[model samples]
Target: MNYTADSIDNLGISLRTFSKINLDTVFIYPTVANKPYQIALMHKAANNTYSVMDTYNGVTLNNHYIASVEKKDMNFFTATPDTNTNLGVTFRAFDSLVLNSVKIYPSQIGVPFQIDLKRNGTVVNSYTGLTDSTTQVVNLNFGVYPPDSNSIYNLVFASNPLINRDAYAANTSTIKYVPGVIRILNDTAQGKHNYFYDWKVAAYNYTEPVPVNFLIPRDTAADAYKIVFTDNPGAKRDLGTTTSLTVPDGLTINTSTDQGYYNYFYNWKVRTNYFKFYSPAEALTLFGDASKIYIDYPDTANSQNVMDYTYCSKMFTYLQTVRMRNTLKNNVAFRDNLVSTSNLAFTGALDAW
Candidate 1:
């Protein structure tokens, strides 16, 4: 499934007539007919505007331009013409499951490159020849031990030959709380990293049913939760209630579709019990007020007994019991208003009143 795909926007080929030459982009095309380590000449569209051309294609490639898009064994890249130098991720993992590999969605096709998997700012491993020609699911394509505890693991792309990445580019508003999954994106500059993007990873090896709890916080400024896995969920993905999930207004979609694309690319799918959707006490503040937090009322007839927040510390339907607790409990002294003398004892229950 090796390909050299042309961009959809034509990479600045003036949809109308007489437009500026697009020299800022290195259009993706197969290395077929073009020699390896080749330095194709630039195509001068106008007086001083020029774009590179594929060597075999000669000059004037349909009134467009081209530049250096090579198959170099890129151990590192200074900066793309788009200036996307660095991209990393800090996300959660299921404690009970061992990590299989990570899944990354490229904005464009990056045929030959290396991905450095970083845990807490340190390089764990580098996956080479990781190509995503069809703009579908990309993986680390390796196995590693799960985190020592349920914590946030970071990802540093180390190499970003792709641009125009797909993320929730709709409104800068709306921060969603995603449960049982690990996904967080930042619009601001994360350290010296040039950019940020939304990506996902998978975990495996669950001895018993463990809720995949990832305490991911929402970004108050930009759209906190970019997108976990919008379209084309990873192949052989976990069986969770993902179909019923709600999506943001505008989620970026990759149009480079090929029947044989995902089949050629190895998308790492980690085997786990199920994804957990529990929000921690700290994240509950994202809603702006703790008192306004909603809780599911199990008793329809006794809505008055409901608490501000209820947590299922442990739940096992097969075990026929669920352990839950209220985060808020209050006690008050109540005296019988009736003047009639009657010996009474207060059990200190709200319902008894």
Candidate 2:
């Protein structure tokens, strides 16, 4: 692109391309000193209308070539102390940015001073400390400040003792700063025609979303379960189970081989083990049925004599007594043996009587 020095001094040149091209950086050389400039990308539609794609602001020419950059800007010049004791400036931002820190030239080194950043006359942040001769960057600590084209922001600088300071002002008796992403309007306390404190501001443009990579451990089990991500549609991945070893089948009790002993044992061990005690009513509900019993005794005429005994009535009477019932319930081994013997005898399978 070819442009004249007059155009570079007064108006910035714009070069249009026949085809679309991606731009990463832009370089500009200004003919004048201390002139503010901006770099922007514009898109032209079919209707010959232009829309801004991106913009970088608060840039100035200082007799050297500079590229369009973001995040930080510093403006400093040779200055002498003036009569002003307290200095402040008001500005507006056209885009979202974070105010990280501000650099100020202290009139009196090692003197206690205060800096206040206010929005709409309300102080949002404040910093008070002794001025340093080497560094004057006052950290704001406020993470991000939204863009407000209408609201005015005031940055105030004050000291305990009266001290003279030099500030930036126009020769035409006006605020002398260019309008860009961040625009300095005028002095807050003194107004538009007064001296405003020169400041170097550090800021950040809102960043774009970054792609993140997640490292997940592989599943090693043969029967590993998979988790499905429903939120990330179209980005689903079939990460197979990591393990190759098959899980052994759960151990099962063989009740038939154990003469059905395991059938009741399994029930008692797995189901009834959770209960600490069974109520008397519950025990009666479980084993309250009565069965016929034949009692055998020695008779005078015969070797064995069989007599029908009312065992149910006697058993009910014994169970009705709380002491007897508790004794049977507490002695689990005795109760199991008595139940086994009674079952064998009732079925005529008792071998040893």
Candidate 3:
């Protein structure tokens, strides 16, 4: 809640009250973190001498006593700290960082907060929710797209963006707050009006539907091989491997045994199946039958519908003529003849030497 010059204090407050006091170089610290801070409102006098206000609380000192006032040899001031702006942390971008979950620490739980994912300065995704009163850690999660693998990214936390941010000042009030920040606090383990802190993130590298080819080891034994994959679509496989593995048959593809190698290093998650087979014909028949059972690919680059390049009729979109890319030598004879440097004989005589 944004606080205006209201009769009572609220969470979202805007402090725009500028004073003509001679207080400069003022130092402040919170008796406790995320709470009201005591400010040593100071003044200057003869020969530019400095005088400190003798109170920890924000006290309006008399103009006459402003100079010779007894300095309070105590710690801090009793003024609320008002930060009315969006605050958050930034992280360096890596290849395919698919961040879908976010966590933050708000000093005052239960208040609403906005969390956004900024990729190259553009907000590609966001999640907003009220902080749960029971827990200090606020969580916001949703399905999100993978931001550009090469661009910089930042996570921004702010008050409810839906709320309009026009801060009002009440009559006869000098102390104020800035708008944009949403803060709340209680007496126990709290400083001035509480603000948010300690932001944490969990993300993973982006993964796409991969094109994989298994070249069965060409052996004279005509042995059988088993290949298994865990279907982990739309999950952060970049944080090492999230896929479980199993060696189906004693005859294993030595490479596929390690989950990390296939999940993180190789980027393959076989969640749904394993192929145990022998001979190209058997594999082809099984694949054909499996395609009917599971209608996975219709018409995409990753589809199993590979055009038979051996025949001209199957290559519809790509027509193969006698002339290939290398045979695209239009007017090659004429072009080459010009380069040979031939001169016409008796076509013209030298007019001047």
Estimate the Cα RMSD of every predicted model relative to the unseen true structure. Answer: 26.0, 33.6, 32.0
**Whole-model lDDT per candidate:** 0.30, 0.37, 0.29
**Candidate 2: stretches off by over 4 Å:** 1-86, 141-144, 158-164, 167-180, 187-353
Tens digits of per-residue lDDT for model 3, 222-267: 1122222222111222223233332232122223213342222232
Residues 240-290, model 2: lDDT tens digits: 222222111211112221111110101111111111122345545544522
Winner by TM-score between candidate 3 and candidate 1: 1
Worst 10 residues of 2 by lDDT: 262-271
Q: What tens-digit string does per-residue lDDT give for candidate 1 at 101-122?
A: 4333444564555666566666
Considering TM-score, which of the candidate structures 2 and 3 is the better prediction for this target?
2
**Candidate 3 RMSD to the real structure:** 32.0
Displacement of the residue 316 alpha carbon in candidate 3, Å: 59
Off by over 4 Å in 3: 1-86, 93-110, 132-135, 142-144, 160-353
> What is candidate 3's CA lDDT for residue 199?
29
Strongest candidate by lDDT = 2
| TM match of model 3 to true structure | 0.25
In model 3, state the lDDT of residue 117.
63
